[model samples]
Target: MADSLNCSSGNCSSAQEAFGLSEGHFALVKAAVLGCIFLLASFSNLFLLHALWKRRNRRTRTQLFLLHLCLADLVVAFFQVLPQFSIEITHRFKGSDLVCRAVKYLQVVGMFASTYMIVAMTIDRYHAVCKPMVSFFRGSFRRYVAISAAWLISLAFSAPQMFIFSLQEVEKKVFDCWATFIEPWGGRIYITWITLSVFVLPALILMYCQIKICAGIY
Candidate 1:
């Protein structure tokens, strides 16, 4: 029995060591991948923006949407990917309460803007293909309205992040930005709302628009 216990303990220690090593390797790989993404997204989007600016006078509705989409993607790269890369390297958020709140707010705003902007563009395409006369009559007005609504909704929806996240002391002196929620139900409710608004609803809208566009074409 003594020998068996010793053997089990040794196996457990080895397993833990292997797990720790693998986790470290994963972190390194993740940081590298995020760094590459940040660089590529920033450079490509900036170049595209410059190209668009040079042709701004002759921009079409679709081109305008693409420009806004590129801007949203840049926000994601800076606010979401860059911050995550920093966290992976440092293993903690390094900032004051205001900075933490601002970062969290902008992160969700980027996600919301990127998603809803794509949805808006898809809906615009749907209108052009499926309802040509209406699209032609009010195209510019509707385009501006849709784009403005997407941005406004993004900003409003992300407001909760500002209140939910703050800098807090995790240990005696070690601080980190963390979210606080009421016990038991708060987190579940918040996550559910986000999933529905950000993913499920947008996905459904896109799928419906795509089907209508295809039917109109065929």
Candidate 2:
């Protein structure tokens, strides 16, 4: 009788696992956290975007590059929030495979574009301070060229995601979202390079430019 009871309990546990996030309470909590993050990011980015957008006619080379950066950030925030919103309502992932891929792509593209644009902005500031008389720095056309280069470079950087992403099922047979090939070691390498190129290098360059500009002003 005990063997039969154990087998019956196992069946009951399996059935419970199969249901996957079928209840609303836990989903609501997740949704609340996700929504707060999205709203905060989106609202902050929207203000930046608005400032850039409102000054459309004052399109200096620097302003134009900033505008694109703001736009890219806005797009990312908008797309990033959708899945969170949907999951809140359904309490389970109801998206198609294509939707998942598209969301991932948007997230990657947004992050890539933002990183590269910040880099471009640093280089622009560098040129403005260090080579003020150069024709390339003087013209608005160069701003467009810089923005284009940022976009292209960002796309190249994120190209690996296309091959690396895959949908997987958890032990409970629930679908889980992840990038399959991006292990911790790979992430460390990527982060190291990204930190050096995007944050540290650009920040140093920007600081140099700011100091030069301030010196010149004084």
Candidate 3:
């Protein structure tokens, strides 16, 4: 039992190592905490999705973007985060190359999709308030196009991770499934670009739009 509770290798293990707790105690605690989080996230996302779908009749621009955001978060929670919890508990990845790549791809796609949805929301609000000449991007067709474009863009950005990561066995010990950079600094550069594009750029745009909105209101 004590052996079972000991830190296996990755995140939970690291925490236990840091806290100086016995493997059994901390492992159960980690498992319980993670299990609760998974359940709460799953239920909350499902409810949000259900609520969004129920309000489909209203289908405003904001609603559409929010629906997509909920879907993206649901995908991340189920396809990426849940599977990751299992890996964190075990402290190793033993899935096939296809499985690994698919999971990693979905993870990246979900992240980018969520980020782009926020950007879409920001742009929509900005255009509706500031550039009324451009119109609020109404109609079902335009909304579908916007959604399709967001997914396509997310897919294009996430595709590189699919190709870069493969199941590489290290020293016949642990199987670590992570992105393999071809160049020395390739991974760092990729992450930095992703961070900037998905987070920083959208944040800046949101801030600019907020300022414009304030100015317009005042």
Best by TM-score, which number? 1
* Candidate 2 Cα misplacement greater than 4 A, ranges: 1-30, 43-54, 81-93, 135-138, 182-201, 204-218
lDDT by residue (tens digit), candidate 3, 57-111: 8766777787788888877777766766776577577698898889878978988
Q: Please give the distance, in angstroms, between residue 1's alpha carbon in candidate 2 and its true position after superposition.
A: 44
Structure candidate 1, residue pairs in collision:
none
* TM-score for all models, in order of appearance: 0.88, 0.67, 0.81
RMSD over all Cα atoms, model 1: 7.9
- Tens digits of per-residue lDDT, candidate 2, 25-123, equal 445655677788788878887887788778888766767776788777876677656565665566445565666666666666777788778767766
- The predicted structure with the larger lDDT, 1 or 2, is 1
lDDT, each prediction = 0.85, 0.63, 0.73
Q: Name the best candidate (by lDDT).
A: 1
Runs of candidate 1 exceeding 4 Å displacement: 1-24
Q: What lDDT does model 2 reach?
A: 0.63
Rate residue 217 of model 3 by lDDT. Answer: 76
What would the per-residue lDDT of candidate 1 be over residues 59-93, giving only the tens digit for each residue?
99989999999999999999989987887788778
Superposed Cα deviation of residue 102, candidate 3 (Å) = 0.7
